[model samples]
Target chain A: MSELLKIENLHVSVGDKELLHGINLTVEKGKVHVIMGVNGAGKSTLMHAIMGNPAYKITKGRILFEGQDITELSVDKRAKLGIFLSFQSPVAVAGITMENFIRTTKTTVSGQQQKVFAFKKLLKERMNNLSMDASYAERYLNDGFSGGERKKSEILQLRLLEPKLALLDETDSGLDVDAVRIVSKNISEYHNENNSILLITHLNQILQLIKPDVVHILIDGQIVREGGAELADEVEQNGFDAYRLAVKGDGNDEA
Target chain B: MKEIAINRLPVLTYRYLKTNDTKILFSAPQVSAAADFSDKTYVTVGAEFPENFEGASSETLAAALAGEKYTITIPSGMQAKLTIEIKLENQHADYAGAYHFLLQKGAKLELVWKLSGTEAAQGSYLASYYELEDAAELKISKLQADLAEATLYDQRFFKLGKAAKADVASAELGGKQVIVHSRGALNGDEAALTERTVYTGTGKQHLDLFYHIDHWGKKTVSLIDGKGALAGEAKKIFRSTLDFHRGCAGSEGEEGDYAIQLSPKAKNISLPLLLCTEDNVAGNHASSAGQVSEEDVYYLMSRGFSWEEARRIIVESLMRPIVDSLETSLQEETLEEIRRKLDAKGE
Candidate 1:
């Protein structure tokens, strides 16, 4: 499979504090890479850093997307390059309707003549898949949406944009069991249809629905261990105690 | 200094006034005021009233009509709508004046004004007295302006015999220095009043909006909604008072909320005052001013919009609901004008 993204020696800081220290990771096309760690393990920070959030400054690193160095690109430019990040907590945007926002996003990304009827039909189909009310497509984007609905809207965007590298940043957070199953189904469908996914999640319940090809244990801003999908089940059953021991035995290489 | 001819007579002038202020004011003098296609009137009032700022209505009318005069009358039981267009393109010339509208018993009136840019120290006053018999309605809207210094002082007194309604809306978008004062009075039972005000300021602009409502009747209802936005070094202060007299039993006065969007280096203050002398009346007020938030920006950006685009969209949407309430033609015109100003600001 072709490689979609490669991050080497990624060092990042939020304000004055460093969040990611000498991080490295790679995701290939048509693969699911699960990033799992305890709380404050910098999973969300790594995703934001990769997506070029201005708040997360990269002090030392290189990010290659589709064989092109994009570490210096702005978030919009990165988005145009087909790099998408589903926010952990999707923010509410008032006034702009969902239809308008989605249409504009598609125009920016694809620039193709949109068939209104066909687009609406497809939106309706995907929304049904995510159990979103049809009227949500007309309502303001994420305004007054329930927690589950907001996450569903994020997945809806992913299904619409079809980005090359989809970074699902805790898309499973704040979702009920039913919502998680539906979102997991949509994520799996996305993997089968197009693009790779780097899901940064703490819950293995969603992992059971959409199996990960590889599971990487991240601790204190560094990947302490890398293994197969079994690694996720092992950590889920045994917790990260052994991994934390391994990270500590290394004499804290980051220090 | 130059000498110009007016009404076939030469007049001495310094620098030059870029606007026909007389013609603009004459076009809309009162509720039924209309431009006289056959006869034109000129009036000008020039007296510095910085301290107490009070002058006679007749004296202010005479200055603008020194060259010519026209009259507009709203008769009993008659309701009329007036549209006035004022355009100014000069500087260094100070324009001052007042216009009067006398509404007879049972009369109703609606007035709308569209103002363009003008030079420094221009002042305006509009006084309307409703001599109502029993039931009457008056609706008014004073819209946009681009001026160096302007004051729109509107004094309205409604003589309510039994039941009357007053609807007042003032929407001002651009100007250098503007002060708008609106006073509404209800003296009859079962009377209703609604007032809506919106203003936007940029650059070194300063705007002051004061609204005073006095209720004297039982079972009176009043509603007020005000909104504002400021950019650059602009500053705005809005003061609103909802007053219920002692004998005004069961009267309800609701203060409108104002939201101000401040760009860098902008300042804003809003004071909504609720005063009640009667124990049975209901009165309340709320106001706020703040900048854009990171989360709002992020929500837009994540969906493929630039920060600038997101900010513009939010601000435009903030006023869209109000603009939608206007007539279709007026809404389109205002939207077009706002677009032009936004483009001028390089947004």
Candidate 2:
């Protein structure tokens, strides 16, 4: 199968210390790749590096999207190229209604103004899929929304955007059981419809609902271990002890 | 009685005048005399405006309205919509002066006015006074924009009777200088009043808003919401006050406020005042005036928007409380105007 996204020996730094050190990975089309690690294992940094977040400086790496170098593209350009990231902590924007925000994102990506009725119809359908109330459409985006509601709103955006490659950044980290189920289901639905998925989460519970084709263990800013769906189960039951021990022996290779 | 010192300044610059409309003709002496009101009733709309634009006085009601007269009588309780258009016929300054409007008892008036092509320090004033009988309701709205170089003094005064309600709002979008003063007095029991103003200014613009709510009636209620945004070197000043008279009891007032400063030099001064003399009355005000926070901008930029785009979103969001208040039909048009004016300046 053709690769949808490829990151080669990626080394990212913030100020003086490096967050993501020498990481290499490839996400094939029509596949879900999960990364599991401890709190500071650079799990989220890789996702931000791929999304081209300005704060994360990509010092020594090349990110290829659809076989073309996209290392220097802005976040918006990356998004227009079918890359989406669900933030771990979504910011609340007062006065901008959810409907308008989604519509703006849609039209801006396509450079075409979409009719309100059609956009509303799509929003309603997506919200229903994510178990969100229609009233949420009129309220301002993420303003005064509960934790579960914010997660669901992000999923709703994921489904509406239908990005080719989605970077789910700890979407299931703070969610409760019911919320996890719904978010997982929405991700599964999006993966089924979209081109690829890159799930960045510490908890393996979400992987039970949305199966991952490949599981990678990231430790000390490096992807130390790579395996199939079974890797997620091993980490879920035994934790990152075995993987951390094995990676320490390997002397921290970049990729 | 000592005569109130009144200054009548006539500075006409706009050459545009409506010749086909007989009401626009300059009936200087008549309009000025009509404005000299001691105790009387008068209703005036367009068409009755003076034709001789140059002869009209920009200072007093007599010269501005050109002695134009229209009699409007509302039965005990009635609702009506009034559209005020400041149209120009010629591109000349003689007709480009200030204007005024006043109202009487038992009348409900909803007004919308358009302004444009007013050169440096040139704008009009709609000084209106409303007298309400028992249970009267009035709403005054003004939409000002398209200014070559203009300023607006849209001052409104309201006197409410028993169980009367008044809603005064103005949405000022495109103008060099805009000063809006809306005041209301609830003199009778159960009188209600609401005054809201939204200003979006760019370039070298100045918008001053003064709103006063006087609760002189028992069980009266009032709410004042003010929102504004300043880009470039534009400046905005908001002064809101809620006063509870000695005899008035059981009155309440609350405020919802926000402002976004987009430019480094942009200034916003918000003064919210509450004075309570009656023991049972409650009044409070809260305000914030600052540029879009650096954290918010960073968060937005991290989400794919550039710093400039993020600032635009913050400013746009800051003004949304007001933008969303418009009628559905006028939303797109208002947004278009906003986009045109704001975009030209490249926030």
Candidate 3:
């Protein structure tokens, strides 16, 4: 497999506080990478940094997408280059309907004007797959959606945009059993030999459906351990306490 | 040319702020043309103005400058649909017209009005009055999209009788300087009035809008909603009042003004007022003005829209409710004008 994304000693900060400490990771084409951590372990910080979120400043290190440095690119520019981040908490933007928003975004990213009728038909089909009601197409984007519905809406964008690299931040956090199954199935279908996915989650429930090729244990803004899928099972069986202690022990030794 | 003070607030404020009233240099136009109506059966060429016709603006000035008048009377228990178009053709042209509508008891009317003009047309003054008897209903969709160089002065009055109701949706999208004065009086028990206005101002355009609704009978209801956006060096002042007079027990009134400022230099001033003279009445007023949300912009940008495109989309969204309320043809035309003004720079 070829490398799709490579982060070299990435250091990220928010305001005056550094959230990511010299992190290094790589995602290969056709592979699913998972980062599991407790809350405040900087999982979201890493994903945002990869997507060029201005709020997450990269104080040091560089991010390369398909070997092209994107450390200085704006969010829109990075998006145009086929990097997508499904927000943990999507904002509700009233006035623009879901159909119009998706069509506009797709047109901008695909560099083509979409026909209204064709786009509507395509949107309807995709929405049906997600079990979203047809009326949601005309409703304002996530204006009054329930939590599970919002997650499905995010995945709908993920399937439609079809970006080369997708960073989903806890897409399965708030879903129930059935919704989780459906969302996982859709995500599994979206992944193929030509693309990659980097998923961030604290729960192992989602892992039961979509297996991760690699799992990294993150603690105190650093990766404490890296292994195959069994690492997630081990963490689920025990907890992150052992990983947190190991990082703390390492810090004590350094001190 | 003469000078007159118009659009005075019902309650006085500090005089230096200029929110109390506006003074404009006015000249009566040479052209006098009647509005084009879709159906002529219920229309008459000339009609006597109502004895108690009161507008938000100076009623005397509106009466003195009026050049043409058309009246439409809907029969009792009947339903009617009407489309009226007022177009000014000449450069530097001026026009003033009066329109009167009478709906008998249990009558219903759906009216759509379109006002347009040439690129360099000077001024247009329109005064419209509606009188609805017991249990009558009226629905109005008004679109004002004249050229950017023109000036517009619109005055509307509504007198609703027992159990009557009126719904008005107005879209003001053009003109160098636009002034709107709308007033409604609910004189009968259970009468209701709902007026929603949406506007967009670009370049150096100025918009002065005032709306006042009086609840005089028991259980009367009134709602006034104003939403708009401002760009460039444009400025807008929105004043709305909901007054619940004595003997209007169980009446409820609500008014709100929400605005989005698109440019740094754009100005938005909103004043929402509620007055109650009866102890059993309910009234609420709210006003809010702010810039576009940074988070919303960032979210749109993540979808590959530039900063400018993101702002435009958000503004369009804010204006969508009113734009969608227009007729299909007018909807497209109004959207085109919005896009043009948004794309233009330093106009």
Please report the candidate that would top TM-score against the real structure.
Answer: 3
Question: TM-scores for all candidates?
Answer: 0.76, 0.79, 0.92
Candidate 1: list runs displaced more than 4 Å. A112-121, A250-255, B1-112, B117-124, B128-142, B145-170, B185-194, B214-223, B244-263, B277-284, B343-347
Model 1, B1-347: lDDT tens digits are: 12221111012123353211111122222222222221122212222212222222333333333322223346777777766555444432333333444456677766665655565435444433444455776666656655645534333444454577766666676566554555566788878877777667777776666666778989988877776567777877666778899999999888865554656678776667787889998888888777766666665666567777766666666666566545344676666655555445621
Of 1 and 2, the candidate ahead on lDDT is: 2
Q: Write the per-residue lDDT of candidate 2 for residues B157-270, one digit (tens) a residue.
A: 577888888776657886665656566778889989887766777888877666777889998889899877777888776667788888887888876567777678887766
**Whole-model Cα lDDT of every candidate shown, in order:** 0.69, 0.70, 0.85
lDDT of 3 by residue, A3-86 (tens): 899999999999999999999999999999999999999999998899887888999999999999999988898889999989
Best by lDDT: 3
Model 1 pairs in collision: B42-B64, B42-B65, B43-B63, B43-B64, B43-B65, B44-B63, B44-B64
Off by over 4 Å in 3: A112-122, A245-255, B1-4, B13-18, B23-34, B63-65, B246-252, B278-284
Q: Ignoring the other chain, what TM-score does chain B have in each prediction?
A: 0.72, 0.73, 0.94
| Arranged by lDDT, best first | 3, 2, 1
Q: Is candidate 2 or candidate 3 better by lDDT?
A: 3
Model 3 alpha-carbon miss at residue B323, Å: 1.0
C-alpha lDDT of candidate 1 relative to the true structure: 0.69
Error of 3 at A12 (Å): 2.8
